[model samples]
Target: MSLCIENLRAWYGAAQVLHGVNLVIGEGEAVALAGRNGSGRSTLAKAIMGLVRCEGDMRYRDVRLVGLRPYRIARLGIGYVPETRDVFPALTVRENLLLGERKGTRFTTHEAYRLFPALEARAAVKAGLLSGGEQQMLALARTLAGDPSFVVIDEPGEGLAPHVLAQVAACLKTLRERGVAMLLIEERLTIARMLDARVAVMGHGAIRFDGPIEAFARDAQVMREWLFVG
Candidate 1:
């Protein structure tokens, strides 16, 4: 497994957010984590990146990730794209990509630009000046510039227009082809379907369902109880 989590628990100050979460991602595989609001999907991503106070086992390949800092985990080949799309507002598009580069990473600014030409067109513009969809693209592109072996992406398709979402999906597909494993966190199944990924449903800070995407589709009970909003 490229990434593995066993009995993972996390908290925000005194508020516990995760409860014994277990998951594994194989090399080059993509898993879509689906859930409604406040179900702890985002917490899982944060735990893996060491952003929250966490305990239990989180292993990235052979490295123990439990006590590591976020930057250390990132240097060990894990990338995170938070839902907030944390692009530097004052930085130009090219400068943002430059910051994401690592010592030996093969992924470069050229590849990032190729994946999203819109970003290249605005290379000289500050990130704060771009539209929301464009900012999202820049965030993803910046992450890719690091050439991470695994990535945890949170709410990637959130608030994106259909056309912009399609572009993001295409870029993710290309990454999968290049053997980068990913955990795609989302509330909607549209992008998951586009990626043909496995499904893992989260609720009450635990995994309620984990299976192939087709299995998730046929599980009316799981969908009604956990996914649908009445």
Candidate 2:
């Protein structure tokens, strides 16, 4: 396994948000963490990135990731893109990408541009002026510039137009071809199905179902109760 979480737990101040979340991502695999909003999916991603206080055995390859600083985690080839899309507004597109190249030893800006062609066209433009989808692309591009072996992406499809989402899916496909593993948190079943990745359904701070995406489509009761709780 490239990433493993054993009984992961996290809290916001005094409130516990995650309860014994267990997960694994094998080498070069894209895995989806699927659930409704506020279902602890994002929390799981944050906990793995060490953005919040957490308790559990988080292992990347052979190294234990728990207690490590967020920067340290990033240096260990773990790239994280939070739901907020933390791109610097004042910087030019190229500058924002430069900031993400902190490691000074991994993927190049040109590589990121190749994955997101729109970014290449907007390299000279101010990052703040880009559309939401473009900002999301820049965010992913910035993370990719750091050359993480595995990526943790949170709510990537949120607020994106259907056309833009298709572009994002194509970028993900390219990432897979490059052998970059991913732990994706998304609501769109279509994207999940297209990726044909492993899926884990989360609710109330715990995983309710973990299996193939096709299994999720077949289990109507599971969808109605856990995945599609509308």
User: In model 1, where do residues sit more than 4 Å from their true spots?
Assistant: none
Q: Residues 1-230, candidate 1, lDDT per residue (tens digit)?
A: 89988899999999999999999899999999999999999999999998999999889998999999999999889999999999999999999999988766777888878878899999999999999999999999889888899999999998999999999999999889989999999888788899999999999998999999999999999999899896
Off by over 4 Å in 2: 102-106
lDDT scores of the candidates, listed in order = 0.92, 0.87
Candidate 2, residues 1-230: lDDT per residue as tens digits? 89989998899999999998888899999989888888899889988888888998889998999899998999889999888998898899999999888556456888778767888899999999999999999998888888888999988888999887888888788788878899999887656667888999998898888898878778887788777755
Error of 1 at 134 (Å): 0.7
The numbered model that scores best in lDDT is 1
Candidate no. 1 TM-score: 0.98
Best TM-score among the predictions, by candidate number: 1
**Alpha carbon lDDT of residue 211, candidate 2?**
90
Candidate 2 minimal-lDDT segment of 10 residues: 102-111
